[model samples]
Target: MSASRPLEGKVALVAGASSGIGAGIAEALAAAGADVALVARREAELTKVDAAVSAHGVRTLAYVADLADENVPQRAVDAAEAALGPVDILVNNAALARTGPIHDTAPRHWAQAFRLNLDVPFLLSRAVLPGMRERGYGWVVNISSEGSLLQAEWSAPYSITKRALNALTAQIDLENRHLGVRAVGICPGWVRTDLAQSPASLGVPEDELLSPADIADVVLWVVTRPSTVSVGPIIPVRPVSKSAQTVANWELYLREMRSYDTSGGHLIDLYGETR
Candidate 1:
């Protein structure tokens, strides 16, 4: 292990790592001296993240696979382990959010959301547990959303699947706690990411939105704790300031977007902010 980085020699596989929260987490893990496997559907974007991960002098493997695919979870895990050894940490950050009322949401969209948000996490977690049990060590972090806890209207598919993901996190922790494997779910409130800037999420105050790196920092902190400490099963992440929920309409969202200027200020102040 590298004396300077607590995660030295560790291997982290981050799903949805092409951008947003997954990308942030991947960078953080690499900086902490962990080799990383970046997974997502976009090969070009994953390649970019791979470059950033490589800059930290740790190994990096970019795997372009949609998490919704039934075979992808185990395939990605197998490939990462083959190249970088067994994964010491698994970050289930991939998710799909299809906006609509429960009644209006199509069956296919609902299934897609569930597959990506809930089933993918389950599959990846299942794949890594055996290796983790044998090694007697591993960390699994599931990236849930505020919808998991809060009643976010017009997003029943997302909310329902994330709620299921929360249950999975708890069950995994309960079953594996005694075996040196810990699983935790992070429910982040309005976050400043491209995905969160959708028409459904309008009117969310800019001040209250969390940066992706904020969640990344929390993930790192959770995994770096003493062996005796097991952080699980859910961590609710709200920003310091309060924000409005979903917008009233698309016009409102468009108006807010027009007024929002992200270029002037840093969304994440790494040194000054407290988690």
Candidate 2:
């Protein structure tokens, strides 16, 4: 919105922007001077972020809508465009991760995951594609997860939906390459957010988890690249001792920590922290 900024004159719409990675991405975009529209289900949460983005000297609009609803994605896109102008950047960051064994998972749960993780991105991208093509410039960044690649033991629904979302990214990239519209998937490792604090996180320390801000920085870097260069999917992983497939073992992790400290009086946590 500010005329003198790098992203000045550009507009961005970020879904699931109430907190975590979505909020961080919205803030980063606003700091770069893009008028931002925040979409999430909770008005109260979005209002708080709205205040923060407005402080960056960019117009911020909060649109409360549930991505699970079939019609909400297009409506939210229309509202964002009306408020912030045509969306030059669309960030599909909203996702629902329901963890359970395949046999135990309900049919509704899988449907819900697909709705948020896959359908919303498809619908919203369709809503904005024509405008972006007409202008011959646009960016679509889909926030995927490492779970898409890893074997999800208890998180089958999440894994399946993310894999589908990744496929959608590739399809869009192939189809829109010549039109100046680019799409890419950003897969983040275990991020320390409200969503990550669960029984599955029992052996993991807070310091070992990646922060949403870290993932947001990666997204910002991807979009800020020269328009002439388009990157494919990116996976951002924090430094951790555990295998990508195995659940973290506290004892092993702690032993490694002590060994590093005894050897060099230095220790690195999972998120690349040195102490």
Best by TM-score: 1
Q: Rate the local accuracy (lDDT) of all candidates.
A: 0.82, 0.79
Candidate 1 wrongly placed segments (more than 4 Å):
198-207, 244-275
> What is candidate 1's lDDT per residue for 1-275, written digit by digit as tens?
65568999999999999999999999999999999999999998889889998999999899998878769899999999999999999999998876655677789998898889888999999999999989989999999976566443354677778889999999999988799999999988767788767523554556656889999999989988878997768998876654443222322442354443334322112134311
Q: Weakest 10 consecutive residues, lDDT, candidate 1?
A: 266-275
lDDT of 2 by residue, 1-275 (tens): 23346688889999999999999999998888889999999889999999999999899899998878868999999899888799999999999976555787789988888889999999999999899989988889999986675542455678778888989999998888688998989887667678654424354456666778888888777777776887985454553635321234322332342332233233333355443
Clashing pairs in 2: none
| Displacement of the residue 27 alpha carbon in candidate 1, Å | 0.4
